[model samples]
Every structure is written in structure tokens, then in C-alpha cells.
Target: MIRYINIKNIFIIYLVALIIMVVLKGDLSDVLARMESIIEQRNEGNWNISLKPFESISSVLDSYNRFGVNIVTVKVAILNIIGFLPMGFLLPLLKKNNTSFIKTMLKCLVFILIIEIIQFIACIGVADVDDVILNLSGCIIGYIFYLIVRPVIKS
Candidate 1:
């Protein structure tokens, strides 16, 4: 039997997958240990937060220069951008009547911020401004692609 998937369903699936990939990343078995470690560190007044934008990008570039290409760093940088592309594309597609670019970008920004906040609170990942920048860039690039393909899809 042929199956059909609607945009809403696709978007929901994508969002869940994205959350799993970002928030629930790494070995699940050690999550409790990691959380306890983070809590202890926090009790010691040590927080994992990076507010400096491009600090991560610069570190990645520096690593590339010094270590002669690190696949992990490259993968992470690329993933940060590529991951959010669907949000930009699918959100507008879902809201056909209100596909305003500004509004879409604002929504994407809010979503990214919420994810970052979760990361900070849960200590699952470093709450870095660079991630926000890169994710937003990906969203914008996705929106651009949407603009390019919108006409074709409409026909």
C-alpha cells in the first residue's frame, strides 16, 4: 500500500529527531553520572557557558590549522548549520498563509534559544552563542532555499 505523509507530520518528526540529536546526544548509560558531575561542578561555581560568538568557529579553525584537520570539529560545525535548515524550510511550508520571512526567522530564533537554555540547565552541552549564530545561519540558508523552490513547488 502506498503511504502519504503530510507536512505537519513531517515537521513533527523532524523536530523530535532534531531534539533527540541535540538534547539527548551521547551515551545514554552515563547520563545520570554526567548530570551528577555537572551538578557538583555547578556547586563549585563552575559553569559551562560561552557567550563569545565565533569563539567556537575560531577554535575549530585553529584546530584545523594546528592539528591538520579534525573531523569531529568539522562535523560539529557543519551539523549545527545543516540541522536547522529543515526548520526554515518546513515552517514556512506549514504556515502557507503567514510565510513572512521575519516572523519565520523570529520563530526559529526562539526555538534555538530554548534549546540552548535546555542545554545550559541540563549540562548536556555547552551553551554557546556560536551555536545560536550557526543555527540561525542555517535557518536563513534554508529560508533562502525555500524561496528558490517555492515557485517550483507551487506550479
Candidate 2:
């Protein structure tokens, strides 16, 4: 079977997806306001540091232990994990033989780190460390999906 996708198309689609993610994460007005606050905070040397490495995950588990996985906790888990799945699918499609998994993962790590840092600085979101972990987990999940679908798509 012949697939219609090429590296250029995948790259363009991936870039668009990433831009969508950014816009969804913070709309322009909110982001600009947050950026102003961030500048003020930086000038005052007063930072908003709220990095919960495992707190949210543990909260979800604890809630599950008590209530057997409610919708709120489920959404938390699912959203974080499913968010960056496209990254996993797009990279391998972008370059087959030349792409290294470790390199790709590291690139994602750095990108996530940068996003988190900006979010934290701008006070746009919680900037949880757990999001990085969860998004990376999502990427791995996406890669697994890619592996499963690649052959089928190729055939």
C-alpha cells in the first residue's frame, strides 16, 4: 500500500500541532498578562515556585484508593499522558534511519522543560514537574502506538 505522507508533510503537521498545544495551554491575552507579571516578578526577584514532582500523581492514586478512580483523577491522568502523543508518532515518521530514540526523547525532555519553565515563570499554569514526567510517559505511549501502526500503515 502506498501512504500519502512524506517527511515534509509530517513536519508541517507536527509543527501545527505543537502550535495548537501552545495556544490551548495559554491564550494570547492570558499569556501576555502572565508575561507582564513574570517580568514584574523577575524584576522584584519574587518567583512563584510550585513544582510538584509526584504530588499530583499521588493525589490521584490516593483518591482512587478512596473512591476507586473518579472522573477528575482519571482526566488528570489521561490528559497529561495523551497530550504529547503526537511527538512520538511524528519524529519517527519525519526521519526513519537517522532518528535515534534516545536523542528524540532527550529533545522532548528539553522542550518540555522549557515549556514548564516558561509556564512557571509566567504563572500561566501550575508548572508541575509531574507534567514533564507524564508528558514523557505520553510520548512513550505514542511511540508504542507508532510502532504498532507503522507496519500496518506501510502495508
Candidate 3:
């Protein structure tokens, strides 16, 4: 079993386990409730886009004239970043040695899409088209990072 424990294989296992946990721990009704609550809060004009000192530095930390992007865009970008962080860096590890990069990326995309499907079914979050785009971008970025760092890791 120790022989089977490699960085690539481990990432795949971790991703699968995470999906299982998300499914087992979250329910459709709970997700639906959370989404509805978010909508209600937005409609009430209480969804302030305030910026914090450390958190919104790019936005100049201003509450009124903050970053140009809207709340929804930020949220989707965050979600995408979260979902793709691993894919960008660790995803290549999942493929056997000598596997094509495109194939590895495709596999990672499929896996992320599955997670999106689960999120949609559970209603824990909205299944916006933007999320898919964001998540893919994240994965691609992660992959690029991985390629750049691959040589360093081998040495």
C-alpha cells in the first residue's frame, strides 16, 4: 500500500473523497435554504460591498468606490479559484507518467464538472454558467503553474 501512495494518485483520492463528503454531509433542502437566504439578503439592500484593509487591497480598500467588479463576479471568481486550485497544480499528477497534458486537463475538467453537478443537485449553490468558466480558468492556471514548477520538483 505504501508503494501506491504517490502525489498524483493521492490528489485524485483526495478529490474523490471530498466529493463524497460534500454529498453525504450536505442535503438539497439545506442548500436550497442557503440560496434562498442569500437572495433575500440581496433583495433587502443589505448586501454591502464593503472592502477590508487586507482583503480588498486591489480595490484600494474603499467601501464606496471599491473595485470595479460586482459582488456576483467576485463570488464566482472565488468559487472558480477554489475549485481549480488543485487542478492547476496537482491535477497533472493524476495521470500516469507520459500521459498527454491535454488528456490530464480533460480528466480534471470532467471531475470538476461532476462537482458542479453535485452542487447544482444539492442546491447548496447556484449552478451559474459563469462558474464553469471560472472553474475551468482556475484549472488552466493551476496547470500552468504546475508546468512551470515541474522541473523544480523533479530536481
Candidate 4:
């Protein structure tokens, strides 16, 4: 029982850390400074919000075609998916009862949505629908992972 409590605590810590890393991807002071600067300048250009899904993916592919191979562009897409895997895995584990797929998905969607909103409001990154898609993919993958591992852990 104590071991279970420790594991749960660890998961909670990891989730908090993940949120900080995703939402505040820099020094707190630096992020605040940029937020202040953007608010003061009212830089419409800096407010890069994308509602259309795959717009970012299309842009990345276009960059790849033009540049012949850009690791950074590819990395962003992959990271967006992989980064949220922990959320999918951890959230269900944190719940006292088994969560249905739809419920788990809703939880993941809401979590990602909040992060995207925060990023947009802070002017830190592009608030992209593609990111939500990719992040949700990661979460689904993570949920699948949890399903696989649950039996093993129980045994």
C-alpha cells in the first residue's frame, strides 16, 4: 500500500513537471518578459493561432521539400505526439477506477486544450490544432500502453 502511494506521488510529480515544461518552456523570468513585451507591443504577428488542422504538418512538409531535410521541423511534430503520452498513461493510473476510452480521451483533450490556450495567451508558441491532434495521438498511444501494462502490474 505504501509502495502504491509512493508510485502515485511520483506520477503526480512527473505530471506537474511535464505541465511546467510544456507550458513554460523557458525560464519563468524570460517567459514573463516576452509576455510583457508582446502585450505592450500588441504584435498581431506574434499571435500565431491556427484553427485548421494539419496546417502545421503541411508547413513542415513544405519546409522539408524546400530544405531537403530539416531535423527541427520533424522533431517538433514527433515531440508533440510523444510529449503527451505520459498524460494519457498517468491520468488513468491516477484515477481510482478504470476509465473508459472515451472518458480517458476527453480528459486528455481537455488537458491539451488548456495547454494550447495557455501557450496562446502567453504568446510563447503557435496555438495549433495540429498540435492538439498530435498530442492526442500521443495520449491515445499512452493509454494503449497503460492497457498493456495494467495486467502485468496487477499480476
lDDT of 1 by residue, 28-104 (tens): 86666667777888889988689988999999999999988899999999999999999999888886678899999
- Per-residue error at 78 for model 3, in Å? 3.0
| Best-matching candidate per TM-score | 1
lDDT of 2 by residue, 1-155 (tens): 12336656766776577646653455778677876776687679866554768888888889899989699778867877777788876676666664566877887788778877767755665577778889899888777887889888667
Backbone collisions counted per model: 0, 0, 2, 0
Q: Would you estimate the TM-scores of all the predictions? A: 0.90, 0.71, 0.58, 0.84
- lDDT by residue (tens digit), candidate 3, 76-114: 357556756676677565443743568766876787667
lDDT of 1 at 66: 92
Native-to-model Cα distance after best TM-score fit, residue 69 in candidate 4, in Å: 2.5
Candidate with the greatest lDDT versus the true structure: 1
> How does model 1 fare in lDDT?
0.89
Q: Candidate 3: RMSD over Cα atoms?
A: 8.0
Candidate 3: the clashing residue pairs are: 88-142, 88-143
Query: Can you tell me which runs of candidate 3 are displaced by over 4 Å?
Result: 1-32, 35-75, 96-99
The alpha-carbon root-mean-square deviation between model 4 and the true structure, to one decimal in Å, is 2.3
- Candidate 3 matches the true fold with a TM-score of 0.58
- TM-score between model 4 and native: 0.84
Clashing pairs in 4: none
lDDT of 2 at 71: 96
lDDT of 3: 0.60
